[model samples]
Target chain A: MKLVVVQVLLIVVVAVVAARLFRSRGARAQAIRRLGVLAFAAFAVVSIIFPDVWTRLAHVFGVGRGTDLVLYGLVVAFLSFTVTTYLRFRDLETRYTRLARRIALDEAEVRGRLEGGPEH
Target chain B: MNTSRQVDTSGVWLVIPLYNEAAVIGDVVTRARSVFPQVVVVDDGSADDGAEVAREAGAVVVRHPVNLGQGAALQTGFEYVRSRPDMEWAVTFDADGQHQTDDVLAMLEKARAEDLQVVFGSRFLDDRTTPSLAKRLVLRAAVGYTNLTTHTRLTDAHNGLRLLRRDVVERIDITQNRMAHASELVEQIGAMDVRYAESPVHILYTDYSRSKGQSLWNSVNILVELILR
Candidate 1:
């Protein structure tokens, strides 16, 4: 119980420090993301300390041991990050496509405007 | 820093792109009046009175009804030069006076004598006079990438102080606006195997230029622009 309390205190301290550093960059969105990551790290720490919780998860997942449940959690986290990264990539692609279309339209308009200008 | 001491009189065209640069437009125009004969000031849809002052200063003013990028304004100046058969070479100059006005003749002389399709007045070519450390690093990285990708040995790729041959103007068309167009120029020009050289030049890092300068973050945009292109 003492170890758990100390771990929680450490986690909160790390998270707050990490969040402060991130916030200074003027990227509120990224700072929030970093806070979320810190929270996730805290959750992992809690899962690690409480072996019984993982045992319960193992029973639910029909796994043999608590370590198996931990492995399962890791796989889930990995897949989640991968999915999120893919979604982010898709969002970036859409944004860039729209941006390219806008530039193309702008170029056509300017070229037309120039060609239509006073003749030499 | 007048060109009179260095070389004889030569027909040098100064291309100044003005977009709401009216505050300093009169002073810049007045300054250029003494030097360049064919100074074409492209008013890129200035809401202010830049065109009037430019014309008053004996500069051949070209007004774009709407705000176009510097590249477009430059193209307009090039078109003007194209029309003028007497134009031996056209100098790509910045309206902000970040570039040295007197160095124009020197740059042109080097370009003309060397028979280079394009001669870039490089600040980093000689370490004797260089811009800020941050600027130098960014410019070096950009130039290095261009050199590697385009197979060209460009020491400073981002410097706008450049002289272009009358014929090579038709070969290259700059479409990218903002600052990324500098890197793109190397790729396009290199594709055509254009003869290029670098000469030492000075940069005036003024408060005005610092304020007007692109964000260091925007250099990433420039890199991405080159990558995408």
Candidate 2:
């Protein structure tokens, strides 16, 4: 099967999204993500008001139909959403692991003291 | 078993990350405590009374309020050991009773003889430990990936039995709350310029341990976690 231009573009976009998953999180990355959401929202409103604009843009991007373009966009958006959510959960898990470890150690210390002292 | 000629392992602490292994943890702790008196079982929010069993079996039990993964439990155990000024060495032992206490003693001897900071138990260094063919292949692949990525050449990257000095334990911070923590630990250790060696260990994959062991599918999750992290 022959690969199309849209296929290459979509693959590249997906690669970029995957790469972003490993990039260090910071205010700059957060700002960029927020701007992406704002731009996506603006585009959604623009497309809803002027549906023909998607078809025109699809033609410029070498996609056959506006629906296919929207689908590809949705795929990238969903992937980024999943990546960010996963990173956020990892961050939260690290924090809680530290917290739980502190409490567990502290409690163990108190119990050890109550039992007289450490077994060593 | 002679108490007079036995090596001074009072400074050594065996850290076992306990989960829902109430059926076997007590026995494991008791047996290990016979050789290494300082045994710490980090109970990772078990529904069973494994913590009580381990405590009664003469192991100091550290209970997590919620179920964190084995990696987190291990880090907690490490932190706990680090707090004890008397503990000079820490051994990360398995909770499933697969690791042999003799192997731990041998590793400790090797560490002390060579003055090494870390002694990793390697099942593939000899033909003593026999795993299933599929498990062997998966473990080889996992170790290959680990060696390639972590800049550390190890025959067994996922082995649960490892001996670390107090300084090495203090330097380690395992954030991977799952199977990936194995590779994460190795990677962190590799980054630290410390004297390290590997000792041949026999893993007794009994019917009980085989049933409790990690599935081969976790290799994929481990790879993903390492890449993403």
Best by lDDT: 2
Give the CAPRI class of candidate 2: high
- Lowest summed-lDDT stretch of 10 residues in model 2 chain B? B1-10
Interface RMSD of 1: 10.5
Residue range B1-229, candidate 1, lDDT tens digits: 2456455334556777788777777777777656666777877778999888887777677776666566666766666666556666778777776777677777777776888888878887666554677777787888888888886788888877888777777666666654666776677778877788788888777787778876678789888655432
What candidate 1 keeps of the native contacts, as a fraction, is: 0.00
Candidate no. 1 TM-score: 0.63
Name the runs in model 2 displaced over 4 angstroms. Answer: A1-3, B1-5
Chain A TM-scores, per candidate, are: 0.51, 0.93
- True lDDT of residue A80, candidate 2: 86
Task: Kindly report the fnat of each predicted structure, to 2 decimals.
Answer: 0.00, 0.72
Q: Looking at model 2 chain A, which ten-residue stretch has the lowest summed lDDT?
A: A1-10
Q: What pairs collide in candidate 2?
A: none
Candidate 2 local lDDT, A1-120, one digit each (tens): 123878888999998977876585898888888999999999999999998888998888888789988999999989988898988988998899889988999999999999988862
